[model samples]
Target chain A: MAERKRRRALLRMGAGISKSARVADRLFLPVVAGAALLTMLLTVFHRQIQEIVSPSPQPSGEQQGPRADVVAYTVDKVPISDPDSPVWDNIPHSRISLADQSIIKPLKLNVPAEPVKVKAAHDGEWIGFLLEWPDSKADTQAIKVKEFRDACAVMITSYPSPPEARFMGTANNPATILHWKADWQIDIEEGFQDLEKAFPNVSVDMYPLLKESIRDGKPPKTVDIPEFARVRLPGTWAGNPVSQLSKASPVEKIVAKGPATITTLPTQDAAGWGRWRDGVWRVVLAKKMKASDGQAGEMVIERGQTYSVAFTVWFGDGGDRGSRKNPSMLHTLYVE
Target chain B: MPKVYNWQIGREMDYWYEESRPRRQAAAVFDTNKCIACQTCTVACKTTWTSGKGQEYMYWNNVETKPWGSYPMGWDVNILKMLGPQRWSLEGERYVYRGKTIFEAAAQSERVLGYLPSDLDYAYPNRGEDETNEIVVEEKFYLRMPHDLWFFYLPRICNHCTYPACLASCPRLSIYKRPEDGIVLVDQARCRGYRECVQACPYKKVFYNHVTRISEKCVLCYPAVEKGIWPRCMRTCIGKIRMFGYLNTPEKADPENPLDFLVHVKKVGLPLLPQLGLEPNIYYIPPIHVGNINFLRMLFGPGVDQAIQTYNKAIAGRDLELVAALLLNVSTDRIMTKFKVIGSSEVAGYDENGHEVVRIPLKEPAVVRPFYDERLQVYRHNIT
Candidate 1:
């Protein structure tokens, strides 16, 4: 009777173990399927889910830490006007991709995105950006009818509130541009390029309304001073910025409201320098941090603020000019 | 793309903008047969308009030897080559272009089918000056009715098209055609030197100024045109080959209008390269001496034969109204609105206000001299 009782207990134990095993087998596949479905959904809508979880990280109440593509580290003396200064050795660079401008009437197609290396440094009183990009050729003279010059610009929103960064800016949101032209750089370095410099072999007999210093009762065969005959040059006489032989600064400060609405500001408070070396263009654009003398259209840079910045580059060898350029999307520029 | 009516092609064609015709289109008709290629018009235009520092090489008006010459060194030939082989089909009386125009042939990224000329291209403006079609060999040096080695002078200026390609190609919309007059102009204040207009203009009339860093073209002397005066080039035409006036559409053709009589009634004046579909306002009376039908058809449209026939009839005294119309060309500085053949001997031109501006006799009075003078013993050189 004792042996039979022990056998019954053993059978009960085995049956209980089998029942638990069966229950585990029944639940295995469904659980795995649920896990897989969740994984696939998360993979497909990860970005959307992330947005829902943390809405736009654009500081609403308090001061936010540096969360941007570029961080303008506070340096005692920012290399404000030098592109090739050794002060840029320690600053980290961020790479930005530039795509063609295709949102307007004139579209540039079939071009691959060009990558640019950018670094920023700010003194207590001024801020500067150093941009370096690859270009096979350096075109510095825009003195020929068919020739265009290489150019680059950094656009910062005039107001702290970030607006849409396309078409330079919309009507309400204006973007101030610090445009550094390769030709203008050369213009500031060398004397203003003239027609003779463009066409070395070209000869002219005389020009109307030109100032003359009579040598032995005869005017010189050639006169190089185009300013003396400004009346003959309608563009120069009409005060066109592009036609000006002498420029105060290599960088031009402009404000834009959509394409073709770029207006040069009367008070130009920006300076820049560009150097082309070994098929690469290194440019530095600098401006005052605070608005002085109530300068109109000036982009004021404040501490502990995030501003939206964009970049544009033109390859003169590729016949890029005006709207025909490589443009970068808006990037967050945080000032520490 | 918008479909616009190009009356020159007699059908709707692709254009960048909607159909907006001017209230009065500024038009001109050039008589190629009477042109002497004196280049006085070119000089007059240069002195009056394009005499600036950067405009040294720019010629708003130029006369080139045909079959060889061009201001920008094969401007026409290069554009034709790019356009490839295009054709025009005769649908009833009006010829419809069967091939794609510059606008229609444009790529998705571009507004017009065009090519930018290099700086050297403009360097040689007179590339084939006075060059003939064929070399005159010693064995066959004799002249024929249609000369074996033939050439003609072709004077060109901005056609100021009813649908301007320059205006359409400009991304900034700097180029504009006046609503008051169909004169096209590049705004000095707005142009950013994109050179799209320079490339898009089939005639290559828009020139880029190196010093100004912008593009400039013939303004058609709007300041003078606003005052009821002809352009400098037209007014100073030594050959009297140009007739400047406002043109109306074919449906509104007026027989009393000189341009209408020559273009619509007599079918003498033909648009240059009407197949291009810009509907250029300038018209040309084809050279009757050129026997090459294909060449004439390529320069002018399918109406070349009819134009030559009408012009021949006018010269042969079969079309007196056409003669009166031709005789009134450049007769006065004022824009002639109406013309009349006065009593079979004179042609009278009236201005916009119905004021008779000019009257010219059909034949000048001739004077004859005696064989010898009465007192002097010197015989008269040949008595007329």
Candidate 2:
């Protein structure tokens, strides 16, 4: 009974310890939960507290845009219309003219000459004067501005003020000629006379009626030889004396002249002349013999033989169709 | 007949297709506002690539002044006049020229090549109607208003296009665009100097070298690119304006990283005539100044504002997240840093999800060089 009572006492003691442990657990759990909740609250409010404590960032005017400004604009709002503005002015039109002058001055080019008067077939109002300058080795071919203007003034005075003149410049060189293509015609002789009276030294001419006729249509009946035509050579020949020939004369000496006819008998002799036949002169010669074989020596003609022959040589008119081969006889000649 | 497998098919099948590789190509961007026209790039290119015979008159790379400037006289004016005014139309997904594409030749039955200038036609200097000499030199003469006189130099090179007109127009099929890098090139052995490429190139960059008897052009310095080196022009630029790097591999480069902004979303642009559908790899960042808006519009076209916006975003630190988004083809993560704002800070930490986080500080402003300095002097140095 005592052992049972001791066991009961141990169980009772174990129950009491378990109950205390449970009570301690309940109290510890609440405290842990409260601490955890407090930590969670502190963590949630940390950022808010930092934000409240830290100073707000300075307002950056640059940062407000897409990026911070690297380049500065000093005169951003300057109006182009403002006179004091830094805008550039437009280039004036006068500069173009200056540039043109700068371009043309380097080349030495001259203005054209005025026109002078000339004769025509029809009669009408005078248009203008046509000027002509001859080509020369000297600079005389050049037409001065004053001369051109004076000629124009003269033509204008003679005719109307606004007259048209066609300038026909020479393609060869610097020579220039101005002519009037109009209804009016000037008297050729009278105009020349007036021009010569005014400028005596100037070589001027009025084209002839025949020249005008040729210029109009058909050519002149008689052709005038141009100054550039070539002359023909002479057919005759002259001789110098023998003494002059020895002195180295420029002319050749003539030995003989005849109609070229021969009269001789046919012979076997080697050194003798033969008869002429068939328009040919013939000769004969004898063979020479060897002295050892008792043969005769060969015949030979002597040097410097001057033959005079005559014949009734024929001659032709030598027309376009005639040949020089056959000559008709006009006369006969005799030689001794 | 039984299905016969050919050797070409076998080879084609064996050709390994890199599925992990990015499909979109990266291109170069030139900030014209920073260009100084120092010609250091020009000389470097000349020495490295065009030092041989027949290249005496060729400038492969040249910086031409606007309004009255050209290489080989008036190349721009002559070409612009020949092409007349540009007109455009979108037919489905493709662009058409004069209402016709390359495939439309079947309907027209006309072998229509691109427009070309007459052989005898050339740009000539104004002789003033009385100027005697062929060359009329007037030093520092201004054609427009005095105070408003402004001229910018435009540096030009072959664009190395995507669908290169030069490649298409070549009868010999000598010109090619590399599939790997998208660099357009012509095989020297196959080019017969027909001058079709010269006529066909809208930019007129391809030129005939008389002595070489072959059509030569800018190569984009493939050898230098292979060696992880910038083109001679980009390397030797005195102004440090030109930047060069692989578009996709910009992360591995330093200093002047071209791909950092170019391949990035916010700073991409292209040379004019991209509508020609050549898909040119060269880009130009428009230079902005306080001038007549109409003049700027006329010079750059209607896209000037967008180009300027992109340029500003590139120079400044904004729109960097946009760049990264475009490159990675992903949405911006909370911890992900934008490319534009990646100043001098390093990677800091990772989130619970193991995403990389970075710390960047607002740094002091740095000095960027002007396009041209007032006191800058140009000098010519010869290399033996």
Candidate 3:
């Protein structure tokens, strides 16, 4: 009875996992569709499955120019992050957004609840993921007031059971999350614009701290001292501080651990990135196997090892951020 | 989720479902009427703590004109706009805010009806100082029609509220309010510079350090407070405006207790924007320049009328007996918990042990200084 009720509850919860999930904010959801889906998922995944398990869709490599129609289950196959890889032809492609009901009641999510087309690949040394989506606004700028950028993340958990401790993780178990931010990607690609660069025509009085100042009519005054040379003025400092703040240079650096542990990347760990654009965004995130003592479990895909994975997406425009984001349930995957 | 009753919202609000009852909660009182906009407290706070590179645009302690200035360039105006016009109707004796509480509005949202202002917004602290008041034109002839123009100096610091939005917004759960003293702080070791706290704080007190990539705020001089020393802003107040101490529980509240007397017993001090329902620990004696009833109520809640009347009585000696006793320790170096109205014009302050720490008269007599000093090398003391 307890298991039945839990499944029923999960079904009800996952029923309205989209914008239409609100069902006009008063109704719970269309129970019929949810019940049917839940029954099918439960039959296969069993009682322990908290996530909605949907069959993988073939990657619709059909974007601008479609050569032909091809469908393959990539989750069951060896997936790579490279978009050009032949494996991408067979993968899950759908419009997916927030599904969990935890944030739905309170947050009025206003983003494209489209299932982002996902393609995966692994080349022994590295595991890569390619996420492509169509957004009218690229929203790559996140450094301004009220400005939000589009972002996506992935979470991996090796432990099957751990008493449901969620403060990052209990003392014993740890989860590794890899977050990729659009703003960080942009900054990494082209350094954050400085005040002068953002506004070339504007000139103002120079404070004592600025290394290079263009005061009114005088030749640009240069501070000769080395110590003062490194001093960054308030508005003048640009570029993402991740590289400057952490030892990692370039923005969007990956830390293996959860939000609590944002320390340096784990040992022997490496990340590769590729972003394609054509009226939309296609981002590829690839990681290599490595060893680390970091509290955040390392992101290493050992051959024949099964791992549980989840996903999170941040649509900056919809003000989707922090704990106020849509996340997916755990799916088991084994790399070969 | 554990729920706490918020009097301002006139309802119970949900917390993060944790048993986080503090052993002792921190509290403070600020007399905005006495503030002179000297910026002494601002400088003292800056030199003591926020002198680092990334903290240049940050001011944990800032003072601005009531209606004109805000450190982050319209922090109040922006929040008000997001919240729109608030609606409230008195439910019997208590006033219940009809609009969404700051938390409720941002229940599952990323921010608490706030925006993280750009670097330019924080560049100037006094951009609109004294500019919100009516502009008066001087006539050629001396017209006898005298109009009263007023604006109060509003000094701001972290309230370290009972339910800090910053703590609730952090996904990493890095921000923690010390159970011993109730001081809200961000654990540098754990913070990822997510800036969620920066957005969630209604007052925008939490700052993101670009260099180290972490959140830092007014530590409330915890190192000094642990040693029983008052916060630097309170201790160095040239205008003698700020009060610092831990608030006693409702059961332990005594009229003689400084924090209780000003905040509860006398009801002279009120929290800034109680409509937000964070249960802010820091309370303010509303500035008299707040002639607009709605403005007054918006800042201090429906207690505006009562607070102003009570403050007027207390400051004007209508209730001099209790007033003098409460403010006696305004000049004392030692932080006191109790006060006694020993005489008509004099009062004494006592420490936690009931030991007298200071006794000051209603007025201190000033003496003329010597014009010349024997230790002077060349110039006289008075002839600079």
> RMSD of each candidate?
9.9, 49.5, 12.2
lDDT of 3 by residue, A1-336 (tens): 999999999887787575575665545456666898899887766632533333232234353112211112224433333455566655544333334425322343454556566555555565666667666667665433345567776555563534232223334445555567675555445544333333344444443353332333232222232344333422122222342322222223244333345444534234434354664666665555443534445555676566555556666667665555666544444453
Poorest 10 consecutive residues of model 1 chain A by lDDT?
A: A213-222
DockQ, each predicted model: 0.41, 0.00, 0.14
lDDT of 1: 0.82
Error of 2 at A126 (Å): 86
**Where does candidate 2 chain A have its weakest 10-residue lDDT segment?**
A92-101
**Taking the tens digit of each residue's C-alpha lDDT, what string does model 1 give over B18-73?**
99999999999999998988999899988887877678889999999898888788
Off by over 4 Å in 1: A1-65, A110-114, A158-164, A211-228, A290-298, B138-140, B368-379, B382-384
For model 3, state the Cα shift of residue B382 in Å: 14
For A134-231, candidate 1 gives per-residue lDDT tens digits of 99899998778778899999988743443354568767677788899887777667766666667766656665665341112221122244456676
The local distance difference test score of model 2 is 0.34
TM-score of chain A of 1: 0.75
Return the DockQ of model 2: 0.00
lDDT of 3 by residue, B91-191 (tens): 89767777776766764444355567777778788876766455554542233322134467888999988878888778767789999999999776566
DockQ measured for candidate 3: 0.14
| Worst window of 10 by summed lDDT in candidate 1 chain B | B139-148
